[model samples]
Target: MTSTVRRAGAFAGVGSLALVAPLLGWAAAVPFAVVAGIAVLVGDGPVFELFARPGDWEEGRLHGLIGFALAATGLGLLSTVEAMPTLAFVGAVLTLVYGNLAAQVVRRRSTDPVVGAVGFVLGGAVGCWIGILATALLNGDSGVAPAFVVFLSASGALLGALLRSVLFERDDPVVVLSVGLLLWFLWELTDPGTVHDVGIALAVTVAVGYASYALDTASVSGMLSGVFLGLLTIVLGGIGWFAVIIVFFGIGGLSTKFRYEEKAQRGVAEKNEGARGSSNVFSNAAVALAAVLAYAAAPIHLPVGDGTGIAGGIFLYAFAGSISTAMSDTLSSEIGGVFDRPRLITTLKPVDPGTDGAVTWQGELAGTAGATLIALVAVALLDSVGPTGAGVILVAGVAGMTVDSLLGATVEGGRLGNQSVNFLATLSGGAVGAVLASGLGIAAVA
Candidate 1:
């Protein structure tokens, strides 16, 4: 048993590295070793605890390592070909840290190897993709940077994971994992280059599509719709495309939240419901397309201030909203789930946990506050867009609450196959908010 355990520990370490190898590259092994050594030296707890049991140690460890390798290898390959930017590198590091932390938390709680493996895979892939894209766009001199980025990123990942394990012990692993990955991906794509724009757009679209498919809730039709929208945004430009992606993330979160509640209430054998929702893809695509159309159809030019011309404003808007939505949703759901009272959205009356259209005062207030915070973030980040641009986000967030309520009260309750209607409603609300803000002379159109 002792020998098996030791062998399992060794395998787990190597396997985890292997899983991230594609994205991190073989050089990532150095960071992995460094991280593991630091973890051991700092008395960070047992490094081998990620495995399930002595009997299952070898398999479990191997699984984690393999996932790490895959993620690292993929990221490395993409970065090499695309020449990622510094921001992308940062994003990757963040994802790695957060993802591993989340996995550790889950493992401690459930002793489920599958969950841990999934968490690592998801986190690593997301981190790598984000880092590669960001680097490609931001770095003026890209060739030399990527070689060192992997090690630096690996170190960051270790820090993030350790922080999660040591600090926020009770936080939901799924939420943390998802948000970490999303941020990493977004940051990578933030730079303003034509090639970066196209590559990021394509990557986002593909990722969203795969997420939709993996979740199993999205139909083939809905996935196609998302892809079509993504393509359209790319044709339109970065601003438009990015805006759409943000909206999609928000909608997707809402849908997933609802589905999880429903599944739990039904006493069904709860599968991983996270993979089912496609609201993120739909909302994001819609926002991006709208921005492009706005730019194309409008007589006035909106100054984006990023040297990328008028389209920059649109991109900023989308990017801000997207990041905000992802953050807000994660915060709201994870924090609010623990709230003493969760209410329905429609009547403000307290209802059962899974009741459609139900709103808890706690949840409603929390959700609004969360959305507002995100809106503010969007405004603050895109300084070039002007204060009026911030106002648009505020209005959109407010309108999103109303739109979400309306959809939940009517369309969402009806269970019309997917969450497309809700997504569309939110998109409409955002468009209305943007239009009103523009018309009110709060901000000039680029």
Candidate 2:
């Protein structure tokens, strides 16, 4: 059989098992288990080898198929659909089958990372739509909205694509299995948000992300990360919170262009002409993202402040502080390049402009300004973060920027990468903000 026919047949065979699930319930695992066993026993056999890429058979790729069966069986055992285990089984099986098939179609089109990511996202949505339709038809009701399903499935697929990029040699089916299971868990177990909220968030994030990409302020992965983070931010905290993140990104990106030609001549310009990527985005935003998640999970009442004050105030402080730190650090490095000689933070000896630990008075001032800008924005937008809270954010940002310099001078070039230092700086900023909030009795922990 041709490769296309083989693929179609495999998808069909696995998908057909969903029908059996409604009848067999837990027993539906038998056929998949038998296939897994055959694959394991045959390891390098022709049936497995026929579809394997170079080095795949040598890595015992067939064994990876076992994960699919295990995932479906786990879903069958744990989740319920319409209070029926059998229908849940059908959903899991169909999700795995369709999601993997769609991912395969995506992977075949290009080797470019951005193309693969875009394809995976679109494919995952299509797969979820199909899975929902199939389940609704087979079981007479799906009990889920297609829009939310598509959103969750796309999120899963994005993760799968990122994982595949990191673990490039892993079998695609195994990666898709993870996506399938996650989509099911998200759809069944969690209350992410309403479809209307998700839809608006998605639309806004995509529009902003595309504009950023077009402006060449962010790379492909940077744009993707922005969309993902923006969507989550809007969903959790609303548009006001999302605006803070965008402001940081916008100002930070623009900072790199300040006297761009001079910085380039000095060999201190950011790589890729100041276009940010995934590593840069995550490093700066990791703590802020954590704070966002914490805000989402915060309790209705806390030990300090009246009613709502302490409950959500602490996370807001941390979020503002972390974002402030990111902006501060970026401006310090970028604007510092055009100033007079910079001294090494550790030795106080003049060094090259771009030296990891270099610092200048102009740069320090610029950093302070950047931090203040973020703090002001936070205070203006968030009712919970008043002037006092903004002060804490400003202090945290400067403190984190100092910590980053110290780390860079001491350990960054040797033991830690630049991204690691950036993450630590943001983390320190968040911690400082939280501690200051507690000390001030704004949001003391219980």
Candidate 3:
């Protein structure tokens, strides 16, 4: 057989076997074969030149073995436990193998086997842990599958890093792997039983996909922000309030990306290129604390609306507020930006759409409606809101917005940085929302 035909046959055989690994109970072996086969076919020619001088066989083999092991371990875990469909695992493994080959093929190839191994191990461990937690928490299923998910996630990330590095030499594999693992961990935490595993998985996938894409695009700050938010959300849970905060920050990041790209073309807004500044931390913390206190102080009653338990109530309201706040900010900003006219938040005078501390009539109305909708939806989803809860959310949302405006116009703008301001504003708005809801007897005063 011709060399080309032989190579093609080998590749085709690997692909077919990969597709049947799960059914055949050989998921672990697929990654190993693919990695080794690619290494053999690619020869050690470039690998030797890159990592070793003319007579350095020891260095060359060590490097190849390290790369192969890392790649195999990652792919094996992802396939076995993550329960990723066969196609994805196969594709990921193939891509990484090809990437390793390409990297070696390059003129100035710089492959760090040690760094790659570390990334593979760390990323794989984190990914597996997250997959296990998510399956246990969300699916309530118990099995020995999480190990595979971790393996696959790690493998995909390692391959992703290598490919990124080869294509974009400045790209750092360790950073990418770390960020990817962190995102997976956060995704797992938010996998509440109430939500479908598929939905949660999709969200997690989007987060991971975005992180990878950002790395590829060389948006390091964006990637970091995505990782940070993912971690924060996981730490906070899938409650409405935290979701809202995520949405707000997510939108802000997107807005900044758009602006940066626009300015890149125009040679403007270069220095301001980083994560968008926001004031969500204080606001979220205050809101969370208030919810906790209110739930603790209020009369604990079972079947209050839908779920029983003080924890449930707190989660309900916090999630509600988070969603409301996030939507309010997004709708206001997006709509306000398009409105023919916008006004400063402190004053009713016209101002630019993107101006901080600015609010247009259109924006205010949009924001109010957005927050109210989120609250109402949350109440309905939880089946907690009676007529009273509905009314409470309306009142609380308006009150929250009012407080948000007040804080934004005064304390938020006074001295604190953007993060501080967001935190304070979210806290104030959430506190006001909770207080108003409780006072009005809309949501069991919690």
Candidate number of the best lDDT: 2
Q: Note the Cα lDDT for every prediction shown.
A: 0.45, 0.70, 0.44
Off by over 4 Å in 1: 1-235, 239-272, 277-280, 283-288, 297-340, 344-347, 373-377, 380-384, 410-421
**Each candidate structure's count of clashing pairs:** 66, 0, 30
Best-first order by lDDT: 2, 1, 3
What are the runs in model 3 whose C-alpha is more than 4 Å off?
1-308, 338-356, 386-391, 394-397, 411-414, 442-446
Query: What is the model-wide C-alpha lDDT for candidate 2?
Result: 0.70
Q: How do the residues 52-135 of candidate 3 rate in per-residue lDDT, one tens digit apiece?
A: 222235434523333443544464566567754333444344433333333333313334443443333343334334434443
Judged by whole-model lDDT over C-alpha atoms, candidate 3 comes out at 0.44
- In the order shown, what is each candidate's alpha-carbon RMSD? 14.2, 4.6, 12.2
Q: Residue by residue across 25-112, what tens digits does model 1's lDDT show?
A: 3353355444434433332125445422343354434333333334433444444455443344345544654455456556666765
Cα-lDDT of candidate 1: 0.45
Assess every candidate by TM-score. Answer: 0.41, 0.80, 0.45
In candidate 1 the C-alpha lDDT for residue 80 amounts to 43
Q: Residue 152 CA error for candidate 3 (Å)?
A: 17
